[model samples]
Target: MAVFFDAIGQGGSDGHPFYDSQRTEHKHVANGGDIAVLAGISYSVTDLALGPWIIWDSTLGDLTRKVSYGGVDMQPIGVIQWGGTAPGAVDAWTEVFALAGVPAGEAQVVAAVWGGMNSQRALRCQTVSYTGVHSIGTPIIASGVGNSAVTATATATAAGRIVGVFGTRSGMSGYNGSQRFLSNDGVGLLMGDAPGTGSPQGQTVTRQNDGPWAGLVVPLQAADTVATCEPLIVEPTISSRVHRAPRTGGLRRKVFKVPADFQ
Candidate 1:
């Protein structure tokens, strides 16, 4: 459960391919050797081989930063690059925090989340028939999806679940390439696809048939237009009793519930 990133001498790797427009796969340089190597996630860390990834924490209404650790009882909130703050909450910071392991808090124990921004993100889909060949720029949608997957047959813009498009060529499931990502989402969707034990509950994405997720799926081929890193404008948690979508800017960190929270 060590959240992996690219290793040295690599750009994009398997398992974890999530990144934002603010930074590319090369941002993870090991040394200033002018050689852009990937510092993919490992149980390893160093001044030269690390990241500036940021994340959020409300484990107890107190925000804490983490590094190089994974959680068994929590799903890391998305990297909080563009800082944000929930109403009556603290403002986010510019420093990036990796999705590391965290401690529990009173009732506010950490849960799973990854605050999304206008950053590129890929989703994993089970093997399904395609409508012809899905190429780059082919818009994706979902139909009353119970989880994060495209349905049989084909879809269009504003139709069903509006997941992102194909970063690479594809006619079936798992179509991401080296620089592309769908595979990472695959692992996340299944939570490492732990066999026999079954995928963790609530790990499945739910769409209300025609219900649209009001957020942005940063495309793999978008431009970096950010002038400077700024604080994220998080929507206020109006009622602590009713936890809603936590937004960064245009993206919402998909929420996951820890079994302990319910049981």
Candidate 2:
């Protein structure tokens, strides 16, 4: 949605009415004059109309007022003047606050600014509050794991099953390159490997009764498959004393067969 920053003269002028500028119960600048306005996702406001003022985004359900603009007395609307150091430029700026009927009690300042020419340029405000947080989702075990404490075992005591892992950390590439250790006995752990130090060591894990198993498993390969293939026996053909089936055909046929013992 496009947000408008166009300003109309609040005085007598032949300008169209801005119905959506403020709340429905509140009155907008009627019979306002035409003034140059800027609007966009990356637009900046001045101290005059920006400071101590109530700013609104498309998603805001209620009007939010700012407590102070650049540490000055709070006002519903703020005005700023830039280029004070520069000749013939107004460098002073003010911020206006928007109050939700109640004054000085539990009011939220949606926006604010510090005093100075580079105040808006400071870009110190937090954008996360407006954007909201997002989850990366849980990670899946790529391999089975066994107790790392044993160190002697080559693989898990039993066929290890993957439980869960993290896809990313803090919205960034999560521990992707880092070595991960996990135990089914609630001993899953991740560690960062530092240079000059021996390989990263697994931290002790305390398994909870309701947590994963005590033994952890990780895949040596990208995916898991059956351990071994069974052999098939063949009898001699009509002319040959003994004949063996074709490796490909024999394995395919043997694998395709349904067990007679299966109900």
State each model's CA lDDT, in order.
0.21, 0.20
CA-only RMSD, every prediction: 30.8, 27.6
lDDT for 100 (candidate 1): 20
Task: Give the backbone clash total of model 2.
Answer: 45
1-263 per-residue lDDT for model 1 (tens digits): 11111221222222223432111122121221111110111110111111233232222233332222122222222222111232221212112112121221211111112333332222222111111111212212212212233221222222111122221111124422122222322112111110111111111222222211111121111122356878888664332244456677886787754332221
Off by over 4 Å in 2: 1-76, 84-92, 98-104, 112-120, 123-263
* Per-residue alpha-carbon lDDT of candidate 2 for residues 1-263, written as tens digits (9 for 90 to 100): 11112121111101112222211111122111121110001112222233235132221222232332122333332222222132322212211222111211121222332221222221111100000101111111121122122110112112211111211001112232233322121111232111111222222322222211111112111112345878787765443233345466434533233233311
